[model samples]
Target chain A: MTTAQHLAEQWPGERPEAARRLLLAAVDSFSSRGFHATTTRDIATAAGMSPAALYIHYPSKAALLAEISRHGHATTLALVEQAVAGEGDPRARMRELVEQFTAWHARGHTVGRIVNYELRALPEADFAEVAELRRRIEEAVKQLIEEGVAADLFSVAETRTAARAVTSLGIDVARWYNERSSESPEQLGSRYGDLVLRMLGAQVD
Target chain B: MTTAQHLAEQWPGERPEAARRLLLAAVDSFSSRGFHATTTRDIATAAGMSPAALYIHYPSKAALLAEISRHGHATTLALVEQAVAGEGDPRARMRELVEQFTAWHARGHTVGRIVNYELRALPEADFAEVAELRRRIEEAVKQLIEEGVAADLFSVAETRTAARAVTSLGIDVARWYNERSSESPEQLGSRYGDLVLRMLGAQVD
Candidate 1:
């Protein structure tokens, strides 16, 4: 009955195949020519369809942006949930999250650009979906920090700030990371996890 | 002299006052509408000048992008130099650098978008300028980490990774930072610095 409940119902069956193709086209066009420079025709051409046909899947360029943005949030949230739900100590949980995160970004590199830089192109309604998901992610990390605080495992005075810093640091890896770089995902993840733990004032053992 | 050196000598002037209005226009259009979406007409309209008249001031859109990017990098390198130069200790210097970085991004929020997100849009030559400055910045942080390592004030085994992590964290703050957030610029700066230092294994005093 609630708005959230209604939206939750819609998310599951949102034309997955059509949405995926449309999103892929949007990402390719936007990342190459950028959001402002890219036209509906570009996306349509990339999708091997007409602009009108594209509209059946996405209402507008903004809608296409929102679709990609939503996908970004959904993908990250699923991975984080899987990483955090398993049994492990707080430190171990953090390492698992980082490893999963690095791998996700490594595998879905274009999604990084969609999530981080292209938000401005989204219409207001579409932007809210990504923002809400990003907030959920922030809350998840903040909850972990709160748990650490409750147990006196970390020395952070402000769990909120620590959560932002930790999350931001990991999220940023998506921006600059290149598989061509010398560090493997596992190596990068371990090293990043070590530093993230230290950022929390936790022992990195 | 080499062609690169000749090109350097033939480089356009850096008169801050002369290009202030044009640069401001570029930043606004670039961030709001994006690089490719924006046109000389948009910029000229914003500056109340003819597009052709604007050309007399700068060579091309690519040239303007390069100059803005060049200025951004120069400002960053200079700030880090000043922040860490003749400093008390590595911890203090890192804090100073973080604080300065957060403030700079806050103040330059418009230009910040183009500086952080325009790498893919940059022509090969322009990218080199930005990349060179980015390298200098990483080296600056690396120097600080090495100093801390030499003093046994921080962990030594992963100084290179630590340096990358620290630089990446600060560079990334520009990407998602919203001034509307509850945290003030200084507060975010101090908190981010704390995390950066922790990641470096810096001893808190």
Candidate 2:
């Protein structure tokens, strides 16, 4: 799929067409101009609607951000959860997890940037909801590392720290990856998967 | 020194007192509220000056951000250069480089966040200047990995990818780190140092 196709897929199909357009426009504005910099009028104008029409779908600019943040976090959380549920030993699961996680961030980097970097811009209640999703995401990775250490497939001194490092490897890809980037998301993900496996001290294939 | 003291040291000592105050205030506001959201009036008030006074120090908000970006990039570039110049083989140098680099990010995360995440907010000319500094920083790490590979101290399939992974590990620290974090900069840096060594396939001490 094209980059634009991938970004459009991030929002749910169940939402109304107007709401979806507003969300997509918000993602573009928030990612490029940042959450604090982007105005509600800009988002409405980009969505080809009047400011009054935007309020019908989302009450405030912060509400629009909160919805976008919710969608992005939920999508990534499901991605990690699926990776964890896949068939494999700890080493295999980890490779799959890192590769898919890295590729997801790289492919949908616009949403990734907003989800990862703009959390602080979220309102207090909205931030708490997203934080819960993040905690679950981290726990899934940590559990995989714990399983690896138990099976003697990987040697790790601190599983929590190792999990953080592994996730950081993928999350930061969004910050740097772009059209000018040399590697495709798949190629970058593959390389990062191997590097993360090595970091975990697993046997490289 | 306290975190506040460490943050203050990021600005050069040679700058005049009022300019330094304006710069520090800008860092605090920009980092917290973000560059797009913060007003010159807010920065001036935070610095205990009128908005007119801020213009005397920085002609515009973008100019203030550019100055902060310049100082931050120069500081980190010098950091990597110093580590690369230190004693021992590539393994030892890589350890020192990751340790110090990671610690710097964790300790000065406020400035680190602005420097790393807010680059897109910079004007065209300023962005190009900071990009050059970033290129040099990446080259410094890549050279150390190349040295390690040549010396048979480290094993790597792709030198460039590995260097990016190593730097990403440290740079992401600024995103998650805060007072609530469990590890001190030193402790976190030591762990990351070992992880990078492992990722490089270097002999871990």
Q: Pick the candidate with the highest lDDT.
A: 2
Give residue A60's error in model 1 in angstroms.
2.1
CA lDDT of A101 in candidate 2?
95
Choose the strongest candidate by DockQ: 2
**If you assessed candidate 2 against the hidden native complex, which CAPRI class would it receive?**
high
* Ten contiguous residues minimizing lDDT sum, candidate 1 chain A: A1-10
The residue pairs in collision within model 1 are none
Over B56-170, each residue of candidate 2 has an lDDT whose tens digit, in order, gives 8889988998998898888889999999999999998899999999999998888889988889889999999999999999999999999999989999999999999998989
Candidate 1's C-alpha runs over 4 A off are A1-19, A203-205, B1-18
TM-score of candidate 2 to 2 decimals: 0.97
Residues A1-205 of candidate 1: C-alpha lDDT, one tens digit per residue: 3322322333455566666566677777877788888889899989788998888877788887777678778878877777677677676787788777765565455567666888877788778878889888888888777776676677787888888777777777777776576776678877777777777877544
Model 2 stretches with alpha carbons more than 4 Å out: none
Task: Give per-residue CA lDDT, model 1, range B91-191, as digits (tens).
Answer: 88878987887766655555667887787778898898789898988889889889888887877568777877777777777776665678766787887
CA lDDT, every model vs. true structure: 0.74, 0.90
